[model samples]
Target: MYFSTSTLLLAALAPAAIIASPVDADLTPEGVPKITSISFSGNGCADPGSAKTSATVLDGTLSTSFSTFKGDSSSNCQIHLQASGAGAGWQVALKEATYHADVTLKPSTSLSFFTTSFWSQDASVTATLKSRIDCAGSDIKDSVTVKQSTATPVWSQCTGDAGYPGILNVNFRPAVTGNEGAYNVKSASIKFEWRKC
Candidate 1:
């Protein structure tokens, strides 16, 4: 009887132990958003003479600017970020992007004696996803065009790669007339979401 009781107890405990086994450590973290890297590319946005250069785009500092001016030509400036990956070795989903900039025209170059300066400039920005860690869906992309002289924020949505880390590219452009006026971009950033299993 003693031997039979001991055997039954051991069997009961064995199943419990197996059921309580530890889960894989790799899949522990879920839905964590992280920024991997950031880069800048442009026709002349980084040039020494341009107002806003690649400095702000590369630096981790958000809501800041390397140069106060950002607009010289349409589609001449581009800022790219390799984000959407968490520290747990998994990729997150890119949701949206926010651009921080003060779209005010460069200080008037018109003579002080001039009663009125028709010099005006506007900024038009766009966003797109170049590549993804996994080619599982349509590309994520969006755009926003605003005309303002004060510091205002704009946003773009990620419509692609709903399950993997991807590249986010943003373009900075300025429209000007009547004079050599330019616009400014202080900073740009991306938002990430937890990827689904």
Candidate 2:
């Protein structure tokens, strides 16, 4: 078969054109929300000096060292995160969260950790993990991860206003008043996922 130089050049460029085509808007890097600011509140972080927050494009984290988080008491903390880049016709949601802690529990004591997350103008979801000790002098260092179901994802509001930020609340509650226990929350992080509005 006879092929012209122009024809061969067009064929050679066809594959490149296909490769350079636009990808799915949902898969774009811009869909990933960036955490612009973070703030901490509540009794768990009462000493603001003991809490720290850091953020990235896809996730945000809060770490705290508690001095008074001890026996028969409950501590609570609220994390406020301002997410940007998703305000442009995009919405974000909490895909998953991980909580890590170091706990020492006396016999017949139980500890529970709860996390609730929500965005402005959105409903919240809570996840909980519990630990119990039957033996004395029990020291536990562990982490729990909670994943949101894709079928019922709680998405952020489609608003361009920066005033609306995501909120995450954590509560640590201990049971059995007679026993002594200590809890130190090492860190907690939430991974965000986004989609077109």
Candidate 3:
């Protein structure tokens, strides 16, 4: 079977579940960007005892956050974004990918943005294929670590040659195998250049 690159990428992402729909009712044609949905393998709170679900990250409010339970030791999640009328699965020229994190959160968590659709870093198996899926930009080349205090969210702005379908996948996982701690995430947003498709 000759599956196109887009086909393969979408197939890979199909199973992971869509963590957040980047645009929804909260987002009017002119309103603060809002996350629409969120999908996860297992969601809980960083404190282990705190009862918080992944929904906290998509509420469009920084007051709350999403965190993995303390005992899990490892965590992975994905967030998807597209313009209001980008048309399902349409490619979008990304400008920025932003997310908030607590300063105390260790560097163990890394973030990666994909143009097409993908589940994990492993999905970018070959260098050739990896480049295709990777959104090329000075701030986007490597796995982005959570920096800037919770008060200051991490924002990776796209410098050049950012091209991908309306579907942008923000994937995150702890850097270490046993990185047991609060993988706290406040919110995620993607800025795309809107154009008639």
Candidate 4:
């Protein structure tokens, strides 16, 4: 129903009652990440200090799947680990296989990044934690051997507390000889804390 300006003006003189409810308007699915830490969801280049992913550039750059970025299963992305370069360091599973990086993240104190999807090499997958911030950078946070099953790729994770926080990158290596398994990596995450700097 439409009301005339004068009619509406008269209504203005009356006391108005207000109501509040959980409207769908305030509810959003893509709200800022308040989980263990922030995860990026935009930008072609997971730029320095930015947490997000863009489909086109990320797919091309990291050689990873777009499943996670599409919010498919909340996986965010999967490593689909490779065995060919297990010992040689991280090599592309396929030409398309790449890293989904969380860059230039500031830590309040000690921070941790967990791998929801782990790397597997038949029976085992050797994990290596590397600081991708700078090659010269030292301090490998945590690395260990992750157990795997033929059916599911196990998620063994590493943690990097804030030593300096320029940038840190994680890498998984081949543990057993000729394990020839696979690195089905997924749900790479980050967590931050304060150190009272």
Best lDDT goes to which candidate? 2
lDDT of each: 0.31, 0.46, 0.29, 0.22
Selected candidate, larger lDDT, 1 vs 4: 1
Q: Give me the displacement of residue 10 in model 1, in angstroms.
A: 72
Candidates' TM-scores?
A: 0.36, 0.59, 0.32, 0.19
Q: Model 3 segments beyond 4 Å from truth?
A: 1-74, 80-90, 105-168, 174-183, 195-197
Q: Candidate 2 has which clashing residue pairs, if any?
A: none
lDDT of 3 at 194: 29
Could you arrange the candidates by TM-score from highest to lowest? 2, 1, 3, 4
* Residue runs of model 2 more than 4 Å from their true location after superposition: 1-32, 59-72, 122-153, 159-178
Model 4 regions lying over 4 Å from their true place: 1-176
lDDT (10s digit) by residue, model 1, range 1-197: 01212111111111111313232323323333344555555653566544333332211232214353355333345555554423334322223334433332233321000000010111243223221011123321112222111111222232234322345454544444333334344444343333223
Better candidate by lDDT, 2 or 4? 2
| lDDT by residue for model 4 (32-119), tens | 2111221332322133432233222111122222222212011222222211101111111111112332222122211112233223
Worst 10 contiguous positions by lDDT, candidate 4: 88-97
Ranking by lDDT: 2, 1, 3, 4
Estimate the lDDT of model 3: 0.29
The stretch of ten residues in a row with the least summed lDDT in candidate 3 is 126-135
Tens-digit lDDT string for candidate 3 (1-197): 11222221211112332324342323312222334444333343324423223332221322223544222244544444422322332222333334443222223332222222332323452110011122222212221222211111121222122222223344433322222223344443433332222
Looking at model 4, residue 138 earns an lDDT score of: 30
Error of 1 at 11 (Å): 68
